[model samples]
Target: MSFTVNARKITLSLLIGSSSLMLFACGSSGSDSSAPAPVAPPAPPPATPPSSGASDTNELIKVNQLGFYPASQKIAIVPDNGATEFSVLNSDGVSVLDGELSQANTWDMDGRSVRMADFSALSTSGTYTIEVDGVSASNPFSISSDVYSDAHDTVLKAYYFNRASTALDAQYAGDWQRPTAHPDTQVLVHASAASEQRPEGFVLSSPKGWYDAGDYNKYIVNSGISTYTLLAAYENYSDFYQTRSLNIPESDNALPDIIDEILWNLTWMQTMQDPNDGGVYHKLTTLNFEGAVMPHEATAQRYVVQKSTSAALNFAAVSAQASRIFSSIDSLSALSSELQSAALSAWQWAQQNPDVPYIQPSDVFTGRYDDTNFNDEFSWAAVELFLLTEDTQFLDQYLSLNVPATTPSWPQVGTLGMLSLLNNGKELLSEAQYANVQDKVLGFANQILAEQGNAYQVGMTRSDLIWGSNSNGLNKAIVLLHAAQHTSGDAKPYVDAAVNFVDYVLGRNPTDYSYVTGLGSKPPLDIHHRQSYADNVAAPVPGFVAGGAQPGQQDNCSYPSSQPARSYLDDWCSYSTNEITINWNAPMVYMLAAMESAN
Candidate 1:
């Protein structure tokens, strides 16, 4: 089966504001000042109108919203009339750094020529803001070594905030607490899923997985890539994640906080596979999407939909990766063996039914992560199986497919297979094979570097800004980081490029709004998340990264411009622009962990 990437557009008939409008009424009584002889308090100094400098106007400063001090930092300023002079002011309102903006021939997507000032020379740690003479001062930012540490934990904990099946108590969830929802212990098998072994109406206990996105659904294909990224983070940076705690219920558990969090999803994923055969359900979803309500309020029965080759292969690949990672833990050896057995079984099942693809029934209305292309999935699974078991047949199958290197998306993950093989399976490959894989990796990295140089210092190209474009940037960064581990000649450029991509998502973009919720100076507030919408909290749940700017206004919300970076709305109504998903956040965790580890 082959699947094409399609953007899911949802039309909302009524736009319900996520925020409440509060009106304050002030009544002054004439007798209130009866003690006038005491001299009316000095008229409060004339109220200073709030400065609109940070407003989306002619003058703007784009930097990482969380700020930077330990590394070289560049501030992008768009002056009203090509003004050259700019000043950086400390929190004390005293000038700290002064420089002239270097005019650039390049123009932003919105037709504004972007000028740059390098304040990397000023390494002193302090809270600061940028002043462009006529424009209002830029938003205050901090310059310290640990500036992003809190944000790193916040983003990682976002997964906990989105956990299903378990209630998020105030103890861990803080302000985002909510009752448990989607206790999928008695999921029904869909009619289309009826097989010779397990017929329709069979009840399965498929409980516990992160909601796919803002919608309360779980998908295997998306979960595969998401779980793989998280595991890769643990694989590469065990030391960094082992001691870091996200304050989850499992913080006191014997396993690292990261491992505990991964297990929350892995346990649910394990249930998605059919024990009778190695087949896996594509997704578990309700008949239709729930409205803007809390998890407990959106009570809908879920059904495990039809099995697909993609799902089976995805399951196999992720299980194999998990098997390798968990084998080292003394308590998890048995579980590791189980995953390895499941992976091999799933691979065999997929081999027999290679053409099985996901087809959403007419009765089902949800985001269909449908992919007709199973070749990449096959390659990925085969590579993992080969690496885990040292099986020559699996390696031969992977080589026979001759999968090319490409950027990884949920639907297209052949490149991830190549990355895993190059990063971990080199000992099993012949010299020629190793060279071939190495060349491909370098080729892909070179392309990304060229794109970065041409596109506003960001690693993604204009075409990359599709739905969930932020993930595209982060996913590309993941590939680059992996490549940097192998490349010998000055890996700093690759690491810096990867860091720049993360910086863009954090707050260093034209929009000046951090795509992640509840972290930056102007983090997104109205994320299109149901729990956040129904929780009655003043802020959305922290750490979930939004699907960045895309020209396709699928939600029909008004955007400032169609330009990639400018086409975003921080409103719950803008589902296409603001919805968060596990796949998007997974790479974020990888990127942040990688950066922190490097530091």
Candidate 2:
């Protein structure tokens, strides 16, 4: 097997010795070193409107509704109803483990005063529930070694559900099969994207990429981060993903399933690049948004809009990064060469036309992923190029800007550069340079933990509950986990905080619902996904992470509350709260794959 061939392996345990992390108390993996001392938790926030009071008695206790990995942290948020202890009961109604609850702490924004119940001491494999003496029992959960395996595959398969330009065969998609849509062999070249070689209305053959979101379109800027995150996961966890098969059309190929799915989009991304000048189109789409209908029914003319510096630099970054990894395998030598050539061409174009932004035409009314700032894009492109070639000029460009790292998103991608560097830059940097890089990474992780004093005890803060807050929470966890993996000393505090953030998205927050569409005790059936709505599937597409709660209420749906964490609406009209996208699911895939590989 080629599982162990890739470079760069780290051997840090996931939160080895936190007070609440005894999932490995009976195990033999003493390979884990001792972790950092626990930070002194801040005083509890005052009980107020945005936070629930001590006397309130609504069902707000939340845990990971799916289950636990048996060798990781296990925690549940319980209401402060004078309960001092909690117990784990087996499915047949027998008590198995008990633990004292932490002091009552009020969440500053989500409106819940709660105590923590950590039953990680229980490692027996069985279905169970957490029960507080005076409060309602929690949703039933299980403890097992293989708790996340199926979820790892299901969430990644969601990419297949979002594919364009091909009919989904019944053998692969089962009931979700549908006809082909948007075969872009005749994509019109818009006037803004025109040149002498290819005038306006040029019919070009550009086909195959996943739909950017619930809307049926392809965007290079959004695809850039989503694709890079998945590739980053593979680069770090190559051993776990080598032979891990996803039963898509290319499952039987010699390449790994993740690479196969990624290639499906990468090929389309390549077509978006113009051979004449190397500028990449920002998006390939119809003039307007389509109505709720099947893929074949909503027939419309598609066009490739204006080329942008953001899209070109993103293309440069992803392609250069991919070329390096593919070159590692002898079988992919040809693809490696081709991707690098495309990347170099894109980099050249970006250098020449460095300020182009996406200007949506007057007639087009689809999603606009416009960004005016290119500092992060430039930094990320330089870093990936440096990694691919080990050129000091590229390294100098990266060092000159000194952009700060944060939780990565489509528009804000400076952190992606830091993550890739942390993974591959150690052997290339001097002693001081590497140390400075490490400090920046760890400093961001420390800031995240220091700011997250809410009752949930996760890594998100009051300002983080914006649109797609779930992705922010998961991306924050990714940062914390990477900090733990790459830093030197006891890594327990960072790892523990990361695990709690994962628990938050899986159903430990104020909403009391698993943010994932499926695979939890309480999941949303009415997601704002066009395919799920038009297909008449009784269940929404499986394994999607919803946008999560925000006070914006942009969709103006019937929301239960106006509080930031409680603004979620699980109906078709609530696009702000319930919509799903590739960028959101990408981090979910990364987190699950990382934890599964760690186990």
Candidate 3:
């Protein structure tokens, strides 16, 4: 089960199925470049006939409000009963395509059966709107070959925008510029974090990382998965990422932009582990969530609080993965060794303190990523360490653990171990072992695809629409992509399923808004992010993906309905439904990049 330095380089031949779907030529030509060009303003549609019976007040199309891929299925929702036929008009008021809507499933939120419009045949590169007979035209959308390239760039750049201890200038940050804040060199070690080497008052220099979400706290569990996703992106698609730049402070570095951005948080994550025993702090946070103030304006004292089995195991997994990845990179070889050492030591610490979990004190009110389950974390660490060091003991531990095949999440990380085994553990694992891992991955993907009949036509089931529902969808997409890479069967269904999840986030869902900021025609303007609220800019930072529609109104904001997909608000007060998180955006970046690269 273990691997050695002499093991074969991980080579993946992703056999994506391109046969089920036909990629149509873009309707409007001359926009073949990777970056989108400006288009003529959309012309108004002709007046509708009264006999068409379409609701003139309601917008008919539901898409990723930003736009669609030239060859991808572009779905639209007709909320009211009326004409089943629709028209696609180009910017110059030319009717480019006309089609009849197939009656899709009914949604519980409004008791309206949505009619599906297939505009995938019109693969034209132009600004256009959808018209449903007598209904009002949809918001303008563009069809382009490179529709998601800029979106991929912006989502990755969001991590840099959320970087603490760094000034965001006009050059990269544009109008959302801010002074440097949270220089955490003097961060106090809380009572729970007191150890033989570092007492309660001990100070540590943990200066940089993206804030956990809308709040300016850092959670090791969350960051571990987020960083791993970014690293996985680089490992899987290095060719696409090697020269890709978002004009960050480290854009000129020899490392790929993705690696450079991940390093910013990796450096901070390194500081979370105690050099004395390799126990990682659960979180570095203020006593309570800070007020809605700019980073420079919020002056609360921060503390590195508690050490838990979850934190140690998470650190072990990420560090081990990092060690394996950076071992080959010339500039990061030394850091790789350090990370490997730290990862092994953290795994050792967790062995002695397996039952320890994060317990928030009575006064601390910040976000808690507390988890009682350590089995998944332990399995993940063992698999990662085994992959890097090829140590039989870690491999033995991994085999003994009952790792789950679920998608990667902060709490459930057994899937991370499963992915590594299926992706890179091929040389080390036995034929039966590889088959077992592959079967598990396929099982998860099949489960997701099985739920495709939900009202939204996205792969997510009703239960998946919880807090950070968009992340749930994106994580599921990640699972499907992995399955597509490994499956011997037709991969188109899995790939299309993954794309559906991304489309849901972009604007294809019932909410009619892109969960990500600044991409869609209608995006969350008042997301519960502090910088977005404090900055004088008209739009929120462009790429931060909001935690999507949650039926549970966990915060104060009033929601229109309790239906799974209808319970979202763009209000700043709706933290449960609208907060932006680094973990949420990481998988989004991965999904977008995967689709872009595949194309």
Question: Model 1 segments beyond 4 Å from truth?
Answer: 1-59, 73-80
RMSD of each: 13.8, 8.9, 10.0
Give the Cα lDDT of each candidate.
0.75, 0.80, 0.78
lDDT of 2 by residue, 108-155 (tens): 666656788988888888899988866777888878777777888888
lDDT of model 3, residue 161:
89
> For each candidate, how many residue pairs have backbone atoms clashing (under 3 Å)?
6, 3, 11
Candidate 1 clashes: the total is: 6
CA deviation > 4 Å runs, candidate 2? 1-8, 13-60
- Identify the candidate with maximal lDDT: 2
Write model 1 residue lDDT over 1-599, tens digit each, in one string: 00010111212221100001110000001112110111111111232232323333544577677777455445544433446778889988999889887754343443445556667667777888888755556777877766667787888898898788999999998888888888998899999788877788888898888987887788898899999988888887777777898999999978989888889998998898888888899888887777777888878788999889999999999999999889998888999999999998888889999999888787876766777778889999998998899989998998899877777788778888888887677689998887777777778887898887632577676556667779888988988776666675656566667777887898777687889998878889988787887788888888999988766565567887776567799887777678888888988898877665554
Which number leads on TM-score?
2
- Cα lDDT over the full model 3: 0.78
Question: What's the CA error at residue 60 for candidate 1, in Å?
Answer: 2.6
Write out the backbone clash pairs for model 1: 1-372, 1-373, 2-372, 2-373, 3-372, 3-373
Work out the TM-score per prediction. 0.88, 0.92, 0.90
Error of 2 at 416 (Å): 0.7
